[model samples]
Target chain A: DQQVKQNSPSLSVQEGRISILNCDYTNSMFDYFLWYKKYPAEGPTFLISISSIKDKNEDGRFTVFLNKSAKHLSLHIVPSQPGDSAVYFCAAVITGGGNKLTFGTGTQLKVEL
Target chain B: DAGITQSPRHKVTETGTPVTLRCHQTENHRYMYWYRQDPGHGLRLIHYSYGVKDTDKGEVSDGYSVSRSKTEDFLLTLESATSSQTSVYFCAIRSGTGNSPLHFGNGTRLTVT
Candidate 1:
């Protein structure tokens, strides 16, 4: 069984629009959540993260919202650009686990011009 | 930018052959990890090292082993390559303090024929 799940395999949005990727987790022990963006032929790059104590965290154009009760989190990109098109993965880990993350299957986001 | 490097960006070998992948970091981070990225499975940890000579297995550690003799280098070895083992491998590093996020390398694509 997967501890983390990204139900949508792919998402597409037009330039200057908003893109939101969703993730769900079954493990209640997870207290820290993160999002990573990956490009073709490259490894994932850290994006934004939110702790269970906070419901929202923002970093420039990227924002992550966490709903602990629902065991869910979402990553939102405002005014998505072509450069924002990439596979987005959501990860989670329990506190004091030493950052051993459990990642989602990932959602491929395409930002059209 | 995270001072992480992965060697053998691409490799193709026959089944039953032994293979080793290397990850090096200049950040002097205390934590190192080896992860495999597959289409449906997302990124799963195979092994990790908290310090020199200290290592542990992750969620998916079968058929794989890791070693860290120095703070800057971590290695992952597959005892015998199998067709099912074909996937992209990534190396990541994190600082020892706080809940630091991971920084990943470019990745190594391995194909077992």
Candidate 2:
């Protein structure tokens, strides 16, 4: 079973607009959530993360919001740039669980000019 | 970028052949992980190591084996390649500290025919 799910396979947004990617998890033990951005033939890079204790976390142009009660989270990138076009993955980890991560399928984001 | 490197960025092997992928880290991190990314499945852990000579199987460790004889290297071996095993593999590293995000290597694309 897939513990984490990214319903949207792809997304497109205009430059300077806000891009929102959503994710959901079925595991309640997951306490930490992270977002990673990956370019073609490259590894996923850590972006922003939110702990279950907090509802939101922000880093520069990226913001992540968590709704623990709904077992859902979302990543928002404001003023999206062309460079932001890539595959975004949402991952979750359970606290004290040896740091193993469960990742969602991924959403391909295309920032258009 | 994290000092993680995955060797053999691309490989093609025939069925019944054995294939091994290497992951090297310059960061001296104590944790290393091997994950496979497939079309409908995001990134699934194949194996992981916490210390020298210590390793554990992940959720998708069936046809795979791993070794960690040293701190800076972790290896994933596919015994008898199969078409089903064709996928992109990624190596990740993290500090021993809890809740730290993982840093990933570029990736290795393996094709089994």
Candidate 3:
């Protein structure tokens, strides 16, 4: 069973448009959620994160909204650019659990010119 | 960046051969983790170390062993390679906080034929 799930395998968008990726989790023990971006041949890079304490967090064009009651979260990047093309992963972890994180399968987002 | 480094950017070995991937951190962070990335699998944890000689298993620890003899290095050894083990391995360092993000290395691509 997948503790974290990114239902959509990929998302395609045009420049200056918006890209939204979704994630769902089944574990109530998870209190922290994170997003990471990856390029081919490279490891994942930290993106934005939101805690269960809050419903939303934003960093520049990236905003993450978490709905605790629904056990779901979504990442939105406004005015997407070509450089934003990459695989995005949603991960979760339990509080004070030695930082062991479980990740989703990932969603490849392609930003077209 | 948490000053993480993974050795042997790429490796190919035959089945049954022993292979090890090394992760070194200059930050001496207390939390070190090993994760594998593959198609349909974003990043699956294999094992992790909280400190020297203090290690714990992650979700996918089967067939893999990790040793942290020192604060700066974590070694993951595959006792016997298998085709199923072929994937990109990443080393990560966490900030030790309850909800901090993880920093990762470039990753090591390993292929077991």
> CA shift at A79, candidate 3, in angstroms?
1.1
Better of 1 and 2 by DockQ: 2
Among all windows of ten consecutive residues in candidate 2 chain A, which has the lowest summed lDDT?
A93-102
Q: In model 3, how large is the Cα lDDT of residue A9?
A: 100
Q: How large is the C-alpha RMSD of every model relative to the true structure?
A: 0.8, 0.8, 0.9
lDDT of 3 by residue, B1-113 (tens): 46988999999999999999999999868899999998898899999998899999998899999999999999999999999999999999986865678999999999998
When 2 and 3 are scored with DockQ, the better candidate is 2
Model 2, range A1-113, lDDT digits (tens) per residue? 99999999999999999999999999999999999999999999999999999999999999999999999999999989999999999999986656999999999999999
Estimated TM-score per prediction? 0.98, 0.98, 0.98
Model 3 whole-model lDDT (C-alpha atoms):
0.93
Give residue B48's lDDT in candidate 2 (0 to 100). 91
Docking class of 2: high
Chain A only, candidate 2, TM-score = 0.98
First chain of model 1: TM-score? 0.98
Q: TM-score of predicted model 2?
A: 0.98
DockQ of candidate 2 relative to the true structure:
0.92
Give lDDT tens digits, candidate 1, residues B1-113.
59998999999999999999999999999999999999999999999999999999999999999999999999999999999899999999999687789999999999999
